[model samples]
Target: MEGVMALMRPMPVSPKQGVTSPRTSVRRSTPCISTDFSKRNGCLIRAQQLDSTEASTTVPPPVSDSKDNALQLKEWEVGKLQEKVAASQGITIRRRPPTGPPQHYVGPFEFRIQSEGNTPRNILEEIIWHKDVELAQWKERKPLVSLKKALDVAPPTRDFIGALRAAQQRTGLPGLIAEVKKASPSRGVLREDFNPVEIAKAYEKGGAACLSVLTDEKFFQGSYENLAAIRDAGIKCPLLCKEFIVEAWQLFYARTKGADAVLLIASVLTDLDIKYMTKICKILGLAALVEVHTEREMDRVLGIEGIQLVGINNRDLETFTVDISNTRNLLDARRTKIIREKGIIVVGESGLFTPADIAYVQDAGVEAVLVGESLIKQPDPAEGIAKLFGKDISI
Candidate 1:
């Protein structure tokens, strides 16, 4: 009993947080299946390994009838598969902590020790981990069935892509998707007296083709209430729910809240996830604004079918670094030809400020720009839009 109890005790804390103690060492026999607990002091902590053949071949039993042991094993297997697939595609941002899943019983003893893999490597990873917990609570409170019913009386979908196209033709410059953001993790409080409806209205009056409302409450200090308010306030511009979407359920949730479009970050999602989410977006009548930060991500997104609008984000979500040149770099000669042929409306997102900045991305071949920090910080976001374009684009 004492031997079993020792295995359950918390690992010794290191002086520096997130740094593993010298006394502890975690060894993986395979990338996803096995963890070597080895010997801790005099205690012979048994290593746990999942059979690769069983993990690959076993069909997960239905959750409704599955035992707790079956469910835990299934979840652990799924997590491993996700990690393996994401790594192959150059995605470093894990969907969950690399600590595998909670192992209720390892061999005969109950094992519940916290592992070093539980620590998030970066800010993006941290946010994603929190989101996993947040979504579980949200799902329990408001399931997909309730959200579908809400959509029955929900506001009619708006033409997000059409609006961008029309705005570009009207202004003879990159169409604007002005953002309604209160604060960002990197920039802190952008607007002291933030009013979503007012800011949205100002953007519409300022000739913004669309409005991107940050819905991430923890990191960006935004909410669905802000999105709903903007729509209910009769803002004419099509609304985009700027969210870190990890699940398809968020599509229904965003649609019910009056989102005409949603943002999908390629850095955090696999190509299969993008395809599946894009299909769901089509069903919900919400445009998917697939965002990419790297050349590999851009290439991955381009290969996906039915992607109408692609946003090149200049800010790296993992590092929160801003560089406008990222926009120009991704839209080089070869990719430019492919994008033109496919008729994809490219939107330059993040780091865009002045008219010169606008011209730089335009010269690189973007038809639209999603600017938030530059416009939302202004005395009037409407005027900020005019200043950004260096001319009045208002209708």
Candidate 2:
């Protein structure tokens, strides 16, 4: 925790009325890793795929998009299958209309310069570069390789999720560490009036095992600065930095924000990336709550050794839709076997507002819960936390 304490940096956020500048800064020196990967194999793979794709009837890129990038548009059509499945289930699906093609951000990789035939190397890149955007990591200031060693590497500091696992092993119900998120892209503006320090105090008073803060500024309306304030205000609950982690740089950054744990969405990354990133989170003394929404994501996580905490997100990321039933759908009987056998601490995330909702997921097997809206709306956020817990947190 100390290793990461000096690491959590103050995020860019507007200070609330009563809040003032923090007397301390949480900046840690970072060790760097090489960001360059040779694209020779990628080019070969693309050439072969392009030849095969071209052999089939020529599918031109959508007129709305660039002509040279035609194949990517065609591939984007396939990613929509997840949406199709949700709609078929009679779930109230509010599909955000197909977005106009987006420009891609090219990463600073050397291999990107060489044109492989025309295909994207992996699915991860497909989601990233589908818009002709640069898909490589660039140095905002320092390269990844250079940041690999200058900083002190921290070890995994298990938090609420970990504590829950311990409780379950002891008495079957791990503690509930609910969130205080104000908004998410999937369900915009979760709570109208939000205060971080107050909410953390509420969660603590409500008997919450810990607090999870959505620190992403763009999508979540959350900030690391809020976390820093939450830390400075002297809350006892540990904080989870809820952000889209596209880089390990963010993990290092999370510790600087006084985060005790961090979320890693499984679908957005490959298996190798998950293993590597989770390991990195441990090295930084932050809890890595590896999240999964599907069997595939679960399988990837299960394959990794020594992973103690797992969260099942009820919300779909691609479509930004919440499916509370996802809690049940994901944790079937077979899953129970693996969970119980391996002692994996499972958490159900999103769309939970009531004690009944908490009971539903808890009955489904999640010993812990993560929520936002319901608690935020309450006059006393701590009471909301207790209500969600179905017990007196004030006790």
Best by lDDT: 1
Best by TM-score: 1
**Scored by CA lDDT, what does every candidate get?**
0.80, 0.60
Q: Residues 45-94, candidate 2, lDDT per residue (tens digit)? A: 11112223332222222334466544454344432443344344332222
Give the runs in model 2 whose Cα sits over 4 Å from its true position.
1-158, 165-174
In model 1, how large is the Cα lDDT of residue 109? 43
The local distance difference test score of model 1 is: 0.80
Q: In model 1, what is the error at residue 341, expressed in angstroms? A: 0.9
The digit string of per-residue lDDT tens for model 1 on 277-364 reads: 8877887789999999999999999999898999998999888999989998999999999898999999998898899999999999
TM-score of 2: 0.63
- The 10-residue segment of model 2 with minimum total lDDT is 27-36
